[model samples]
Target chain A: MPAAPVIAIVGATGAVGVELLGSLARRNFPLSQLRLLASKRSAGREMRFRGGTLIVEELTENSFDGVDIALFSAGATISRRFAPIAAAAGARVVDNSSAFRMDPAVPLVVPEVNADTMQGDEAIIANPNCVAAIAGVALAPLHRAFPIRRLQMATYQAASGAGAEAMQELRDGTAAELRGEAFEPKVMPHPYAFNIFSHNADIDPQTGYNGEESKVIAELRRIFDLPQLPVGVTCIRVPILRAHGMAISIEFDQVVDPQVARDLLSDAPGLRLVDDWAGNHFPMPSEATGQEDVLVGRIRTDLGDPSGRTLTLFVVGDQLLKGAAQNAVQIAESLLPAH
Target chain B: MPAAPVIAIVGATGAVGVELLGSLARRNFPLSQLRLLASKRSAGREMRFRGGTLIVEELTENSFDGVDIALFSAGATISRRFAPIAAAAGARVVDNSSAFRMDPAVPLVVPEVNADTMQGDEAIIANPNCVAAIAGVALAPLHRAFPIRRLQMATYQAASGAGAEAMQELRDGTAAELRGEAFEPKVMPHPYAFNIFSHNADIDPQTGYNGEESKVIAELRRIFDLPQLPVGVTCIRVPILRAHGMAISIEFDQVVDPQVARDLLSDAPGLRLVDDWAGNHFPMPSEATGQEDVLVGRIRTDLGDPSGRTLTLFVVGDQLLKGAAQNAVQIAESLLPAH
Candidate 1:
């Protein structure tokens, strides 16, 4: 890239965008210049970076003129329209939308799982879905030891996955619920306070799987390089703010002992074992809110199968951190030469 | 039975006890008298019934002297202590606790599933756990169409299952969360506001299954009369007030069509089909709360199995109504001749 890359954060006013700024600062990503870009509505907004104020400018084709790296977290339509322009302008684009993830030409990178697959010479790199990123990081080590044959997942997702407005909606809805007042849903389709439902994403008419669940399955397969791996996912949105939790069951080609899996997960990168059976503490969303490492626990043999080839566990990870912003920052860090 | 049996309600001040009173009144059970029984602390409390006030009496050995039917929801300790005394005093006891559920001597009854197994003359009848009861009502219809060979379940349980104090703890916890204050949990082990956790039950170290999960598995096996059927369950407590939801995957010996399952569930007793695919609405805890029937939807073939023998669905039910009090009252009603 440049001697020290000039970076631009598209959609800098959104949830993941705000987190991207914090992640770059917290991780101390080496950069000579930082640019904040957003829609016209947030054009005049000021955000602080490295103890200095930076004014957000309206994103346009000319916004990537001198930028060496652009991190895109805007909606898919915006990314699809602007990512190519940024790439053509000689800036490397790391897109956080689902638009380019399934493209054979694009490399979906988690950094922890498949950093080598990302070609530095490529103009754009795609980030996997939040659920996929979290699950891929936790499942990679185990899959390396014993290839996973099948996976069944049930997700308890938080409001941040939808966007910052959805998070505010959850807060306002819950406050109204506490006040015994009716709060009509604006961001989400249903009442989100003190209630849980299947993911609000559109369902596949033939399969009945929602968009999030389908994305998770496809992204996990692509990230793991297991094209034929069978995955069944049911995604539900719970009334939480930031972190996402999943209950997963995996069947391996060979019989795997839970202790062996636990030992492997304990030493795995981007993961921490929080399984304290006696304490009745496992991976909960509240404890995983601001943590970088995904918390994993409740490692046990699946009682449904007697063949010892199945294992079940629960995992939680910060959706804004490793699920999006931190992962994107890590990919950027992987591109730079070792200091 | 005597003309209009004299009914006694044990633990008349608890969460399920309150629902039991409403259910009895709503169903208009033919009763000559209603006796409210609770601990000495609540003995003097007066509750309204049939537009008249009844004084709560202390639950002593002599509380069942003239009672024809006794409904016990106090707890296992209280049920174990006094249910036998009531039965020996010539009253049929319907216990809503884990105390006698697995006892071969006591018939575990869910009127919708296995009411025929219950003999009216039996001195004691045990109700299934709330999770088991809800799952039973939803799964019985499907299992009958095609025998289920394997089952996997993940539950989203509510606060009322833990009792009235725990429900209040949730309410207060939410209010404290809204105020940005620290809430030290008094009824639950963890902070339950906008958080989810593994069921707060003692884990079986050898199996890694908690008590509630184990009870659900055992109760399902007993109710279905499939002694060797395998069930894998992970029970979680969510931050909802009343209803419980479950995501279930079933593997059958033969292929099952989703349309068949939907039609059967719609016609089945104690279940309401809420699968609105076009509207993107399925069973939700908020809709299931205070509803008599368990809501079932999101039925589709399991993508993990190519054999076409597996299906997955979602369900929600009011824990108090069909899960606990209503089912117990139905058992009591089964004892009386037609009005």
Candidate 2:
């Protein structure tokens, strides 16, 4: 094998960061040495790796001193603070936050869709939102067949995308409800055990877009470079812990056949077509949680518009894997020229 | 009020049936005499209504004797075999299953939306599918505003819609997962606790439509009498036990406005506006489980479809209440030519 890449994982103790490590090990990414970085609160902890244990270190500007590649899964604030430092330190950085996504200089990429556009000398590649990342994995093939004119999407997001605390909150809240025990809400603002919450969190009140919804729209447009592309989206937080599902309605410039969409997605990169309505086996969260590929199903030509130019389907993917971490690693592996 | 219309509740032992009795009492639907009927398996059971014990008798040809109005929340098969018997016995039957929803002679009623359509001459009234029924509460006002040309809907249904056993399976399956006990699937064909199953029951293997999706499409057309009105729907069974949520996208012939749609629904009977993203106060299953009105939110113009003729929104309602029993009872309350 070729010499391994020296990779550093920021926020290694967080949900997506942990998955980033697992995905690398599972795919056997050629890694020379793994540097795990977290906040002071989680520094000095030990976590599992390929076949050994790695010690977590506190993250600081100087921490990127010798790293070859830095993957950031921390929150936007942390990424905003450290990503530039890591990039300035001569490391290629793949950011899994909205921080640098809309920046004209930083390339937002899903390798299979925009790999070539990612390899610019600026060295910071932004990851799209999990919903867009997963949707793009399936839609890219169709867009190849018939360039999309407009897209309508409603997402059912998992809690893990928020952070480890959100994941714990869902697991513990649900566990508490089952035991008929009182569970104080700390991870999320509301009770989230069996209930599905609106994904529009912290409304801007002025623009009528919440933090989550705004991120989805902005990141999606930036990633696809369809600034004028008509898009309508409503983000919902469902009770699932790790996978996100989306009901996507697409309107293409030309007529669409359900079989054609299914055929394209059947072997699309990073996508699994599980659309056998005969077996009741369309993609679902419970089945897609630990999976790496985005699952697409309920494939059909939507006659709702009788003009019949739309194809509506459902998509499920592990929010932490393909949505965030794995995509980041995959991008680093393919390092687009625009990054 | 003139003496409460003599009322009867059939299949009063099921989940919807139980909710029907409570709703009738809570809504103070006029009731001079109450008769309860159930299958032989549940015969002689007792239920409390209006501070008195009501005996459930075995449903027979004479079950509706002396009944002025009969509300049926039984399964479709039971309704198909018995609703006509009750109507023949001089009682007006309002059925909450799919049995008569598409029958040309029966008026599928959502009193708040299409009360004027009920002439009471059919003797047997049908309640639309829970999601379809609740959707009308929103669509009727919008249809009046722009006239619906097409509908694209994705349903997140609760287990309670299947029956009491399905509800138990969800609770039991979840509890088992919590207790570290391996659970055997019985009531549900698959795992139910944290999982969202397909809205379909038993795929036909030939025609891909599930029983639930087919009913939603057929019932909507019959209720709207626009047999050609384009409808594309996907029914998903979620872990929610009693409420159903739909992410609906609609196309209209006239220009559509999101704020205008919100205002129309705010005062529309059987519909509640829950669009406050600032408060994170949108429609939800746990909140809508016992509520009568369908909760609507995330109201937005379909920016992706720039012709300004499309709008999208999210709606939730109690499958057992507004979607089923309560709708049936409301129909019986207003269907009689003379109350």
Off by over 4 Å in 2: A204-207, A336-339, B1-3, B202-207, B336-339
* lDDT of prediction 2: 0.82
Best by TM-score: 1
Alpha-carbon TM-score of each model against the true structure: 0.99, 0.95
lDDT of 2 at A288: 93
- Per-residue alpha-carbon lDDT of model 1 for A1-339, expressed as tens digits? 865799999999999999999999999888999999999999999999889999999998899999999999998999999999999999999999998999988999998788889766878899889999999889988998999999999988999999999999998999998899999999999999989999989999999998998999899989999988889888999898999999999999989989999999999999999999999999999899988999999999999877779999999999999999999999888777653
Superposition error at B88 for model 1 (Å): 0.1
**How far is B257's C-alpha from truth in model 2 (Å)?**
3.4
Error of 1 at A64 (Å): 0.5
User: lDDT tens string, model 2, A129-192?
Assistant: 8888998898899988898888877777888878878977887888888888988888777678
